[model samples]
Target: MANHELLKLTANQVKKGNYNKAILAIGSCEAHGLHLPEGTDTLVSYKLSCMVADRVDGLLVLPPVTVGYSGHYDTFPFTITLAYDTVIQVIYDILESVLRNGINRIFLMNGHDGNIAPIEIAARKIKEKYPDARIAALPQWWVTAGELLPPDTFEVWNGLGHGGEGETSIVYYLFPEWCEKELATCVVPDHLPDKIEIKWDFAELTNTGNTGDATKATVEKGEKMTKVLVDCVVDAIKKLDAVNWDYSSTNAASKL
Candidate 1:
């Protein structure tokens, strides 16, 4: 609802200035169990970006990159994925475009876990090209959401699982129409002792295609979680904006 979306802004409005920081919300379109919608990651990323951009000064929210790498969920129907190299190139191009337009402060708010590495790789490449550019890739829902929640609020894995308590609760509060509460199901995988790691397709992990406890999710918890996450986002964006990023010719001058 706020005027944070850059796509809706006119060229004259954009040239009016004040918006120096741009956020690119990156997510994936994939199976998020039976209860959650396929566009869960994209929705969350866009919503969080809007919330942050609206609250922070000189922040503009760009349209989200809805499709991301989801090869791990190949067994699940309707899951879309891009090659690792392809994703990196896509992020690089987007960043390059924005940076060239004079928006050097960039934040890639990642909603899907699979896009994390690619976003980071792209950010590194951008830094190599533009030494004055300030870029960051934040794992918005993965790390930040769980950190905002109380330790006792959810089980160990429930707070940070695919279509689990955290995500289900978020959807319930933000978009109740999209949440299928009646069909909510849980499918936590068995833990291997000695920290042994086992990787497999979606079907191999869980028939329901969900991990953690969705049954435990409630709209009330979702409301609280959303507030905390939004506040965290606003605070983080403001703090990052205030930091000095003149590590360009200034550093070279010191050497000289």
Candidate 2:
């Protein structure tokens, strides 16, 4: 029952807690679909970050970056998009601030696909400046969830796509009130090749602002996804803590 959220803790509590690691959720504000909320990405990532922090000792959950680059999804209404460089700078600044607070073991939990490149760029910049900083990231939780679960867990497009079955299911489990299940819909892009990566806009993929079989989503699937994702992060953090966040073979070789 220890307080792990930086935003919720007092300075005295934080000092007493002596947290050495932190998590920052990077998410986007965009149209998930007619059924899901606009802040679906942020809500999901932030909630997962909280879940991870709750189980990990000495781990602090920092305030999330709620709005990320969503230019591709701007064809839909009310999408907040940041320029690529701006997104990079924002993430860099946040990470820099976290490092300044003396917590160098950082974990980034990202929720939107558009922010992936920016997160990488920002993390690289932080590493270049602070080589001792041990940073880890779950850049694509959606993909990770699918990989962790059984193949048949999701009934459509492998639970892939914006506001798709997997995404909707998780939201439904975590924030069911935000979802209008009656309005849920999907548009699986059958034309796109399986092997090649296509940089298509959201408009090109689906007219409904979603690209998966959302109707197949359910609370049970969401609950399962949440557990696996949280467990995955918690286990990884414990492993990192076991070595004092020192995974460098060079350091190990020196001891040898």
Which regions in candidate 2 have their CA more than 4 angstroms from the true location? 250-256
What is the lDDT for 64 in model 2? Answer: 93
TM-score attained by model 2:
0.96
Report the lDDT tens digits of candidate 1 across residue range 62-143.
8899898899987776899999899999999999999889899887888898898899899999989998889866775655
Q: Write the per-residue lDDT of candidate 2 for residues 81-104, one digit (tens) a residue.
A: 999999999999999998999999
Which candidate comes out best when scored by TM-score? 2
TM-score of each: 0.90, 0.96
Top lDDT: which candidate number?
2
lDDT of 1: 0.82
How accurate locally is residue 214 in candidate 1, as Cα lDDT from 0 to 100?
Answer: 88
Worst 10 residues of 2 by lDDT: 247-256
